[model samples]
Target: MERRNCVVTFLRVLLLVLMASVETTALYGVKLKKKEHRNAYATMMYMGTPRDYEFYVATRVLIKSLVKLQVDADLVVIASLDVPLRWVRALEEEDGAKVVRVENINNPYKGQRYFNKRFKLTLNKLYAWSLVDYERVVMLDADNLFLQKTDELFQCGQFCAVFINPCIFHTGLFVLQPSREVFKDMIHSLETGRENPDGADQGFMGVYFPDLLDQPMFHPPVNGSNLDGQYRLPMGYQMDASYYYLRLRWRVPCGPNSVITFPGALWLKPWYWWSWPVLPLGIQWHETRRQTLGYAAEMPIVIIQSIIFLGIIVMTHVARPGISKLCYRSSDKTTSLIHTALKFIAIWSILAAYLVPFAIIPRTIHPLLGWALYFLGSVALLSIAINSFLLPAIQVFVPLIGVFGSLLVMAYPWYPNGVVRALVVFGYAFCYAPIAWSSVVKVLARLHVSLEREQFLKLVESSAPSGFNKLF
Candidate 1:
């Protein structure tokens, strides 16, 4: 009994010691982190929703620029739960950003006609000042482009921003200290409805820092800008995207601005790739997204698959029997065989083309949509292939095989998510069913006739109305 008691005592003591060491280590790490951020600052941005994830791509570009300039600051992404976990991980692990998840405070007047499309969570911008760990921070809108590192802005006072328009300061970029008092003050103003005239965060901030543009200049700029001189940022710090075109009109390339803000009024931004004349910097945003970790990883697999499938199709078409037989044959044998093969290949080629946008475009908007589309698209392609090329008897097992493979891929440790897995299965079946039906009909129609490609084509063409031949 005494021995057992001693063992118990020893175990308890060991556990206590381990606990104490862990606590000490954790506390020490916190201290080091605080010390690191004491004099340093952070570059911050807010994004929420899949549509807004479009802006996250732009944010990645800004982060890369800051990294290249070797700016002395932390990169912070403040987001809501609407953003996907994969995106959070990408920003945290790949881009070296500290992601803070916060509940979005929606606008109280959501039903107002003018307030329909704007994010009520714009109020969340006030949270920046509450991040007390950082001595100062520069908050940016996701639409801004970083032409050069503006790290020097950290030296300015609490409310430094640009005066791009005559009446109000632009919130596309601004510097401020994190303080609970200021945060509460802004929150109070919001609750009381003392918002900016424009009804966005820009207007709210402009109301709060009304004198920023005309304040007297400080003797020796406390932060980077003259604190009293309306905290005006240098003209080169932020430029309008239109300025790029204006420069081009004169056939000039060089510009004085260090950063470019998109046309805020028109809601036109670089990522809308379909824009006419393709905004000069649209390609730059796409390249940045492709270079980003999660997005980049998906592209090579798609491109390789597309190329392989296309190669097989081209080779098959080229190696088929010579054109003379197809052109001169009185009997429909050659035409039938060629048409059957062409029809099969055509279906798959069109599906592949339809899936290309889903691969790259959906991914930029939301990882879940990207993943759902990819898995479903794969199932659709596989279904069409089996139904078209294989014998009717063997088609029954194709979906089962596809389901098993899809489940395995989803179950793998790297891509595991119960919700995503369920979605993939639903999407897979939804996309595959209709194509499978059409294939079954085609197979049945051919069953009463010859199974050989040549006979099948002849049979189909013989049934067509007379005028169809002249059109061909």
Candidate 2:
């Protein structure tokens, strides 16, 4: 009886252990599924200015495209206290769209310099929102227009955050799964301004999610040879007016029939009204609000002034005989011309040298400083021109003299590359040459004469004292 009891007891103990193991395994699977489901909601955030009518129109187009894709999603519009709520209200009227207006928080670091504080505030808000119910969200700048539906982004799952590579992290386009941990980390990262602060969000992710660097979830999309990132999106998406019109030629037209987002770099926007023909009529009308009335009115006036000033300078030099005689008698024309030419060469050499450092040094910080120095040198040249024209005897030789001074100063023994050093020398010379030429021309033009032999003798004879013989 005792032996039978022992066998039965052993069997019961084994059965209990097996049951507990099965229950634990089932619980683990359930927990994993629950975690996966938490990241299922599709969401996108847009921050825009209240007065931006063009941006509003673009947002509508984006919403229409998203609806057409049949993806269940929400669009959140972030606005500040200064912006009217009507903008958000107008967007929410669209079917299946929700616009949330968040008040801008005061940040001193932002806008103290040339930085835009609004963007940083919106980023902070997005970080806070991540702690809420949504599983996944996309942060898009207000100017983004969707060419096609991007619902496949959800497939990247919780482990991956989708964004464009080779771009600044703050570029305002990214896909992330919402988590309290990430939210806390992002907040800390923003507060400290450190990429990987001790226990901060972005930094923590960089360390924990090192895999992200290699398996970046979304390589920026490509369609028919078109690249699709926030910046490189098709012409139908947000086209930067600065990069398009001012910086580069616009090869494609931006219009409504095709979707285009407008990021409000107003000073840099397309000034030509004709460029809008590629857009839908309604969108064209919307974009017109972005046109600066002051800039448009001033452009013609500015062109007229420039033309008049140039004509005055040219006519003054070409029309005066007395001026030519004075120049020929007082200054050695050959030496003056040679000096002018040498000054040109010297300025050009310096400019070339300045650009060499920019090309060879990978860090932008030093190059930016170099640009500031170049700009200051240009300003000095302008000052010399004004002084030479206004005060003829001021001996406006500073620019010519400064050329060699700058070259000697920039040629440090530390930079040993001959090509780089040569470029730097050329850059300084290039920059100073224009200033020197401008000053010389201004002085010559103010003297009031063309170098003609017949007109020179007539002017000298007329100026000779009464009854005095004129010397040829």
Q: Residue 407 CA error for candidate 2 (Å)?
A: 44
Query: TM per model?
Result: 0.53, 0.36
lDDT of 1 by residue, 102-215 (tens): 566556545555764555667667667766777777787776666566666666556666566566666666677777677767766777878556566776787788776565
Taking the tens digit of each residue's C-alpha lDDT, what string does model 2 give over 197-223? 222233334544555434434333345
Best-performing candidate as measured by lDDT: 1
| Model 2 alpha-carbon miss at residue 266, Å | 5.2
Each model's number of backbone clashes? 13, 38
